[model samples]
Target: METDMTKGKPMEIIIRFAIPMFIGNLFQQFYNVVDTIIVGRFVGKEALAAVGSSFAIMTFVTSILIGLSMGASALFSQFFGAKQYEELKKAISTSFIFIFIVSLVLTTITSLFMHQIIHGFQMPMETREYAADYLRFIFAGLIFTGVYNAFSFLLRAVGDSKSPLYFLILSAIINIVLDLVFTVMLNMEVTGVALATFIAQGISAVSCAVYTIKRMNFIKFKRKVILFDKKMFKTVASYSILTAVQQSASSFGMMMVQGLVNTFGATVMAAFATASKIDSFANIPMQDFGNAFSTYVAQNKGAGNIERIREGMRGVSKIIVAFSLGISILVFIFAPQLILIFVKKEAVDVIAVSVYYLRIVCVTYTLLGFLQMFYGFYRGLGEVNVSIILTFVSQVTRVLLAYGLAMTPLGFAGICLAIPIGWFLSDALGVIMYKKIMVEDSV
Candidate 1:
């Protein structure tokens, strides 16, 4: 069901939308948690480390897909709220065709150069072959991932978050079932989980498309409307291109960090991997909430509800403060227990390093959450270049700090510290840009 977010109380609508999205994203993230646990315990640390390395590389490719989908989402939400039926329908098809082509091209390129791409990151020898094999299988489903995400974001843009949750739940179930069968039962290792994820992507993509065609008549395209509209193409391209570059740069920066972590040996690599996933899992709720907040702003922007958007931002700030502080405390306290879940009891060094990363970094979730909220705020306002600038500045700082400090005595701890610093810097810049935008709008 399409929701008219422009009509509801700002926080109320956002929370309602975010609840389902948070759950869906949580389950989607569970795919990785399950893979890490299964591969880490059943396979070995080497396989766990390899999966981690491969994850960074895979994320870089998928980030482009996500960036484009986010762009389409802003456009979709805007057009829907404004009641521009024709423009909305045209954009739906335009963005879909554009994303499909990009996905296909990426899949082809990544598949052909999978080995070279993985090696380019300078992964450790112990895990290079493992990473390559995992990536080779995982890249097989790029198109499905691209298609699923494009539609999922589209569905959410128009306030249909519940449907994606349902489809993703089904997909997550398939992935988990296959994870056990291939990794545990058949002993396929990291490759098994990769294939499982790939199959699940296919299922989700197929299910989302089938559901959209049958149920989402609002976004359904007619033959005439399917052709590209010059205005619509320009609008979407303005949003997608820079956002795609920023998103990919952010991942590339992480890949750079992974390369740095890899130099410290597989213990650090595995620890970094374990800590990264746990951190990401802990933070997914606020992140999803940020996305939900963006949709609310976008819809209101379309409706020209400036006061409502302001109301939403203020409400979210309170939530960010309360939620970030609460999550940080929990992650900090449970850091050791969380690491233990992924590592054997005897791997003392891995446990220590992973726990160290978690505690130090978890303290910065307040800044991180605010940064995400700002990113969503600007994205909703159609000021994507602000987002690009904030992201690039932060990522560049992270990469530079990761290398510079890693050379000093801090080592892996230096890499751990780089993250929060980056978030804090980005959030500062976000505050500045937001104030400037508000001032200009007043003028």
Candidate 2:
């Protein structure tokens, strides 16, 4: 369908597009958070910590696939906007092949190194075993996750965000139900949680792919269409590498932070994991808006409509700022209740530490809001390298800050403080880069 997202008023367009994405993204996080709550309440804190510890490693593997999908979305949106139907079809086909190969290789590599990678994080022995079990199962499911995500990206690129959202909601419900059955009834512990998640994601990915292939006429491929197009593959590969680097840098940095959290012991690790789920939920609005803006800007840019792109940016900025402030207030006020959702009264200190992190980081949400949008903005303009550079700068600095601070008088709180500081710096750099390259080029 790939309708022009830039035609309507920027705010209205963004809201329309973002609402579905927000719901979908929230549901996506719900699967994990709900699993944590169920596990913490039913299984135990160590189990929760184990599942949480594997998060960064899982994210590291998944980021490459996500980056590839984003590249496909960006490329498809541009081609769709230009009304190059045949080229768009070819892009879609090439993307599938590219994702399959990359995901297969990544899955194998991560699976083989799973134990070593968890060990490298230097987590407690109790937590490390659980984390290793979880990672092994999750790594097995990476290919399905990658394929599903690629299709989701393909759908979103063509202005059908609603479909992917529908599938995600279904998958979240499945994951929650399965989590209860596996963990509570079967007493499968962390492995149960991981298996439930993998099954849910697999089902969702299959459902989405089937629906897309059957219903979306544009993506239906002929023999020639299915054949990989060299030019389109090259274009996607070039842009995708930049995105891959950006994501790799970010994930690698988080892995570093995870290492620091591991040093603080299992309780701190569990708390960090719980807090991260809440943080992910809170940032949904801004994150979804950034995604919408990326597609919006890409479509408009392809049409050479600079004014529409600018207007979209302005509208997104206002919405993100308002949303950020609202979330900050809510998080500060409900800190205890939010923390209690995944932690317990005995672990109240862990909750307190998490609340401190969230409260402080809340101040920088608006900055992060703008920063994410600008990253999407440049990506839409096919200026992926700029985004990569900014991500590297920000993530590298965040790691350094967290590592150095955690060793000092500030301790865990110092590590928590690193987030807002990173956001501030990243936003400033993103704005500068956008102006220097994209804005200047437009003028």
Candidate 3:
């Protein structure tokens, strides 16, 4: 069921559209959360640290997929909303073909450098092998990640968020079953988690791709549509490159932060890793809302419904603030309990560190929520270059602050502060940029 967001009550449509996405993202995070929990409880803190340490590198690859997905979503929303079905099919085809090529290149390169990259992260000596083994399998399955993401993004782009949600629900189940079998029954540890994720994602990708193309008349592929269209290629590449740069840069900064955390020893690293999983879960709704808003804005922009876009933005802002407040209070209360989910027996120091980190970061969720929404809106309007600059600024501030604060008496506290500080700065700047872009467009 394709939705014309440009025609409905902005709040109603936005909420309905976002709910499936929010649910899907929650299931999506289950992949990581499950991996961390099993690895921590069954394998040990060292194994947990290895998985945690791989976050930055995994994020680096994951960001490219995100960037490409954003590109497809933005463009497809525009085309579908404008009723340009022919061109829309071409765009969809072009995206799949282009992503396939990029995936092959990235998989080969990353697979070759798997060990070196782990070492480059300055992964602690004790957990280096665990990290390398996990990352190698993940890198080898980059195509699965890329394919699933492309299908998922394209589905959301055309207002079929439900399909993707169904696929993710199934994938989550597959991953969990595999995680238990490999990690518990067979003792594969980190490698088991990686393999489980890869296989599950691959199944979802292929299944969803077949179903979507066969079912959606607008998305059906013809030989002509699948062939490279230079114009379509340029359009998508323009959106993809800047978004990719923005995401990769942010991930690299995180990698730097992880490297710094690695120096603090495995206890702190475990704390950081566990804290991050909790953090991702808390922010899931916000991220999904941001994406939903982006698609909404893109569709309305194509339909020339500027007023609808404004209403959608204001609507999502309220959603962000309300959800953020509720999540912050919950996380503040349950920080310790949440940490225990990852480890069977909590190390006192790791629990204390993780709780403190969560307390500092949770309250600032609203700021991060607003920042993502603004980025989504800007990208939807095809002002991706501006979004790129804003993202770069935010990531740089985070890295610099992470380094500076880690050195100060604030120490790890400073490292914690860097997150909210980055969020505050990014949100502040994003609002300003949004206003500027709107003003110019209105004229």
Most lDDT-accurate candidate:
1
lDDT of 1 at 150: 89
Using lDDT as the yardstick, the better of models 1 and 3 is 1
lDDT per residue (tens digit) for residues 21-94 in model 3: 88988898887789988998889889889998887689888888778877777998999889898888778888
Clashes of each: 0, 0, 0
lDDT of 2 at 169: 93
lDDT to native, each model:
0.86, 0.83, 0.85
lDDT of 2 by residue, 1-443 (tens): 45578577888977888888899998988766887888788877787888877787777788888888987788889888888888888888888898899889988898888888878889788877778767877899999878888888888887888888999999999999988899889998878888899999899999999988887775556666686789888888876767877877888888889888988888888888888888888888987888888888888887788888888888888898899999988988898899998877788767877887788777677877887887888888888887887787778788899989988999988887888788888888887876776568663
Candidate 1 Cα RMSD after full superposition onto the native fold (Å)? 1.2
Would you estimate the TM-scores of all the predictions? 0.98, 0.97, 0.97
TM-score, candidate number 2: 0.97
Please give the ranking of all candidate structures by lDDT, highest first, separated by commas.
1, 3, 2
Q: Model 2: runs farther than 4 Å from truth?
A: none
Q: List per-candidate RMSD values in Å.
A: 1.2, 1.4, 1.3
